[model samples]
Target: MTIATTGEADALPEILTERRGAVQWVIFNRPKARNAITPWMEDRLIEICREVDADPAVKALVLTGAAGDKPAFMAGADLSCLQSVKTPEDYTILEDRAETAAMALEAVRVPTIAALAGACVGEGALLAACCDVRIATPSVRFGFPIARTVGNCLSIKNLARLAAILGTARTKEMIFSARLLTADDLAGAGALRGVVPDDDLTERTQELAEELAGLAPLTLWTTREALRRWRDHGLPADGDADLLRLCYLSADYQEGIAAFLEKRRPVWVGQ
Candidate 1:
């Protein structure tokens, strides 16, 4: 069943939900923007996560991008939205929404799978990292190119998440390089469960999701929760604000956004 959204008749919802047997699929549908997520989409995603968690019949939750000429799980946050964020407060609000959405998905009771195809960068990559398993096509390109494109920084919690999956050194390199990592790279790092051919992506993801759905739910839930707790064990409750403020409230960040919109190279002057 498709969830209806309020918008122009020809406009598609930013998020779409489909239920097939015991697997629930949540799709990012803004193909025109390379499926860049918006605030509305984040809200919808949180709602879907809650729905999936409350429904015992849903054995697996699969997240993917709607097919397009250029497939993208999610390119990142909508540039238009990011362009509007100018203050540390604005960035904080945005980060909070994103964090809530990610946490909701991570807290789901059943197994979660990310079926990735094309570009999965920035917020997209973070969401993918939240999944219990990621199955991708060879064409997938995943990373946070913020240093080169957005001049923004990831929250400490986000860094921890990536470090947990890819290790501290790899995560630092991924951000520092400002380049998208290939599916093979991620698979080698053990970040992805598997990488399949583009043609076999859907079939392989379905097979894996179904296989996971057949597992003991309690065992899966216990493992997921335990790992999450372990990851958060030593995390600090405060102290990232200065780091975020330094980036978000800088001239360089605005220049980065302007340059990106203008299709020109950003001239970063470390402020």
Candidate 2:
């Protein structure tokens, strides 16, 4: 595996960077908090998705940890953004931003891998699950604890994707109980292609990414689009439009935005 790392202080802090051959990487840099997804990172994440989609040189993209050493491949949403969310309205705006990033992950024109390690929780799990492939280490833990942590909802498209990938029973257990599954458990449940020792995770991920990158770009993109279309069939028309509306029209959305910019807890008025 050819590894190339770049540290750009001018680059967005919430997300980091690296590139290998035709494989482009977008690393979630908030390791201290287990790679928590911040609002700034949200925009950066979408931008990276667009960047890869538009760049002809990037045939396969990987979303992974910075050097694959974090305690979490991705932990989840940044809870710091939730305090001012007093009403469902305010909550939806935040959710919309997150869903946009997630949608971009799904819509990437090239093959994508969620090279997961450590804890893949909540939003992180959703992000990984959005990828075309998920590779994990033995130490990885996966779950969506939103039912317990916040009243936030997952977009129907993402919910359907999860159900398709993990199956109804397994998806139900994870969401309903907010249970965290170890790598072995997730593998048995068919959530990941394979699990390796921690040391081999990064190399194996690179191997897979490079392999995909070698394939014909148009073929890969067409395949991804076909799968996406199939998933869309399972979702209702205007589903995403409604999700966007739910967030755009919410009072909580207003508070959440203000609070995020202010770097303080949102004082929700439940407008």
Candidate 3:
């Protein structure tokens, strides 16, 4: 995790929170890096998720990126930022922060809506999967492009969540191909609440959040728990850390990260 210096707590938060009527908006605020989050940022988001859970007045949550000229919801982790890692332990610290935030947000009693635009890749898309619903604009693109880029493995929790939403076959295809699925593709696969034009995304998201907020509270909480439990059930308990080590420790994995930063194709020896 990124540690703050003596008084870094006085600086602005990495993630931004805004309370709007009955909705709590959690925006991924790292715009220059496409909202690519650090371990510290993930911790902040997880804290926000917990705070929202404690507030009964917050009936719903809306997640989005800070809309900029390019407007990425969130993309793959900043390649340059991740290149500092030298050990499995270091990498796990970063990955686990993101995973913990996803689970925290997903477990909230109130519903979540990910209003996405632009690219949502890797851990970013994993966060969207945690939301109770997703809506996006035509400009949105979603994928895990690590196969061609980082060569890192997904955590068991992330893999299970993907499998639950897209099924095993489709998830495998997505990783193997390393292609970004467009908004339409994600909608067709049941990962989205259908596409809205870029201009209407905000309005549509608020409308959906309102609808969810007005539903029976007990039913919403119960059904969400029912869903959250199924995701963890029956997952393979063995070999997850081994898989992470085998891949992240490989020469090819280093090559992948280096080549990506250098804007060249990685030469993989597979060992």
Candidate 4:
């Protein structure tokens, strides 16, 4: 199936949701910004996740970046959205919305696949990690390069998620080095279900979705939940809510965001 498009000019919705047979596609549609996530996008995605999760007709989901002049899976949070965040309250609100969306996606109770390519970073990486499976092109670059760019911290929940996928030492190296790993590297580490040619990405993702859609929905969902429960067992009871507030309210994080928007290097004062 051709990747679905809307409008004559292909004007994209923030969250482009399409139901194809028993598979649901929740596409991130801000390709110009590398599908960088916005707050509204977060809310729309959560709504879509809940909608599909509740639908008995839907058995699987495929999430990807919308086709654009420059195709990208997802780069992270939109810098413009980051610009508006000033206080701890502002940051908390943003994190809460993201957390809500992430939790909703995790709770979908269906097989979920992330069709990732190009650049997937920061929050985008976290989103992909939340999915049950990931597929990407060999050239894809992804990681939480916050140390070099945003200077913001991932909530312990997200850190744990990545750690579970990539292991503790590799996770440390990924963050501390502030480098994006090639798709091959991540795949070799068992982070991706498979790696395909760049041109075959969409088709491969669709094929996998269809295959998953044929499975017993109840069995698939229960297995996903079982793995999630085991993963959650490692998390601290209180969660990492406070960590988000701490980093979001920091002067270094503010400087990082401002510098990124200004297209300059961030001068970290380490507040």
lDDT string, candidate 1, 40-117, tens digits: 999999999899878989999999887776778999999988888888779889999999999999998889999999
> Which candidate wins on TM-score?
1
Which is the leading candidate under lDDT? Answer: 1
By summed lDDT, which 10 consecutive residues of candidate 4 come out lowest? 1-10
TM-score of each: 0.95, 0.80, 0.92, 0.93
Expressed as tens digits, the lDDT of each residue in 1-271 for candidate 2 is 4222323322437677688888888877766667778899889989998998788888788887654234567777776676556555665677778888988988888888988788888788888888988888877888876544433456676788788788878888888887788887778878787888777877888899888888887888888788778877857755675665554455655655556557666655544
Quickly count the clashes in candidate 3.
Answer: 0
* Poorest stretch of ten by lDDT in candidate 2: 1-10
**Which has the better lDDT: candidate 1, or candidate 2?**
1
**Colliding pairs, model 1:** none
Model 3: CA > 4 A from native: 1-13
Candidate with better TM-score, 1 vs 2: 1
lDDT of 3 by residue, 1-271 (tens): 1222213422546577777779888877766677787777778878888888899999999888765557678886766557866698876776667777888888877998999999889878988888889999999988898888878888787888887777888888999999888887887888888799987887888888889989998999898889888778877765488888888778888888899889998987888
Span of ten consecutive residues with least summed lDDT in model 3: 1-10
Q: 3 or 4, which is superior by TM-score?
A: 4
Ranking by TM-score: 1, 4, 3, 2
If both were scored by lDDT, which would come out higher, candidate 2 or candidate 3?
Answer: 3
Quantify all predictions' global Cα lDDT against the true fold: 0.88, 0.75, 0.81, 0.83
- Collision pairs in model 2: 84-266, 89-250, 89-252, 89-253, 90-252, 90-253
